[model samples]
Target: MANATSGMAVNDDCKLKFLELKAKRTYRFIVFKIDETVKEVIVEKLGEPTQSYEDFTASLPSDECRYAIFDFDFVTEENCQKSKIFFIAWSPDTSRVRSKMLYASSKDRFKRELDGIQVELQATDPTEMGLDVIRSRAA
Candidate 1:
């Protein structure tokens, strides 16, 4: 998820470890931090985080700046079909580490798809998020 504020869509082509954006001079990658607990929660809450490879590729981004897609593949599927009934811890020590770090799930609301991973966290728009601004002329 790229928390995009404008009408930008990820190019539906190309498959690489990372995505490069030329327009805004940025780059993104599909990174995954395997958490058995988080995976289980996803399957229960969002219904199976794993999607068909075809579907995943269809939402990929081309070598353009418009947008990029981060595809996260599951190396293990032990909790793929299970629900939150299990003693799963989503955040784990991951949350205690830092608060500013933005991961895949953190950007879900802004992101369009569920399978892709967002290696680079998008910049937060001040106006959109609603924050007071005070500007002063140079003394």
Candidate 2:
């Protein structure tokens, strides 16, 4: 569904892929991009279940705005393994202003379409969403 506030639509594939990730653990992460010409949010990349966090990080462009969801697994201080679904808004400083604005505005609506997100993070650089930060949040 598209939201008038953001002037962007979330493709059905976005939600479908999210469900697949959340329910089946089929993906380690999913990156979403707003297709300017289409005025809609679409799946730009899917990280394989076996992909590492570094691989997911590499999939993002340095000068672009993207939405990503990562299935982060970590061990708690109590020695229990747990996973948290992280919803990340990637808005690099080098990205186009228009792109950044559109993504920032559209993110919430797009995120709302996907259920079961346990953590929400907005990052302008890699360090902001680093493994350490994710681990802390998962804790």
Leading candidate by lDDT: 2
Across 29-66, the per-residue lDDT of candidate 1 in tens digits comes to: 23223223322112111112344323422332221111
Clashes of each: 1, 0
Cα RMSDs of all predictions? 19.8, 0.8
**TM-score winner among the candidates?**
2
User: Considering summed lDDT, which 10 consecutive residues are worst modelled in model 2?
Assistant: 1-10
> Candidate 2 on 13-105: residue-level lDDT in tens?
999999999999999999999998988999999999999999999999999999999999888889899899999999999999988999999
Candidate 1: deviation at residue 127, Å? 39
lDDT of 2 at 60: 92
Query: Residue 65 lDDT in model 1?
Result: 13
